[model samples]
Target: MKRIIAKQEHCMGCGLCEVGCAVQHSKSKDPIKAYNHEYPKPISRIRLELNKPVSFAIQCRHCENAPCVVACLTGAMTRDEETGFVKHNPEKCMGCWTCIMVCPYGAIKADVSGKIVAKCDACTELSVPVCVASCPNGALECKEVTS
Candidate 1:
């Protein structure tokens, strides 16, 4: 399956990925409006992790044995049979935070309203995620990882 890989050395900490993510998930499909409303207040699904030697965006791996999917009490998180992408269903989510606790990467985040968990879905509707599209530094790239 194809997944997003970050080139830490190229990251500029511009936070375009977060903005793109929020916009992609928002009803408005507008970055400015999405940030004002549906944006995850403090935490983002994809985050820029800074350290001495590295600073890069992190997101769901869509693991084969995804712990988040197994941890979800209401079956809110599921893996796509064809794409192997981890997808979340907001209506089924009970705001239990089980997925958040189980995700090893800490990629899962609560929605802006704190009503549901959110994570990368690879922008299944688009050829690539808005994050990759909006990244000015070429720091983020989505490519298929072959077995």
Candidate 2:
């Protein structure tokens, strides 16, 4: 399967990925409008670890044995067999936050206003996720992996 990988050596702590993610997820998909008009606002699915000597962006690992999947009672989190991407269905979500508690990577986030938990779905709707495209450095890349 192809997945997004982080090359920490190349990361310079630039936050363009966050901006790009917010804009892409925004209702208007516009930088200006997203910052000014979007209600409930958009958050970057990718989060950066700023610890000294090593800073890299992290997102959902989509684990083979996903604890989040097991923890979800509302059937909102499910993995797609064809694409190997774990996706969230907001409609089915009851916002119980059970998934958030079990995710070991701390990848899940609460979208209180949206009434759904958020995690990286790898931007399945796009050819390349906004975070990967907007990265100023080559720290982030999408490559095939053998698992």
Which consecutive 10 residues in model 2 have the weakest lDDT in total? 110-119
Candidates in order, TM-scores: namely 0.88, 0.94
Clashes of 1: 1
lDDT of 2 by residue, 37-58 (tens): 8877888777888887789888
Best by TM-score: 2
Runs in model 2 lying further than 4 Å from the true structure: 112-114
**Best lDDT among the predictions, by candidate number:** 2
| lDDT, candidates in the order shown | 0.83, 0.85
Model 1 CA deviation exceeding 4 Å by range: 37-43
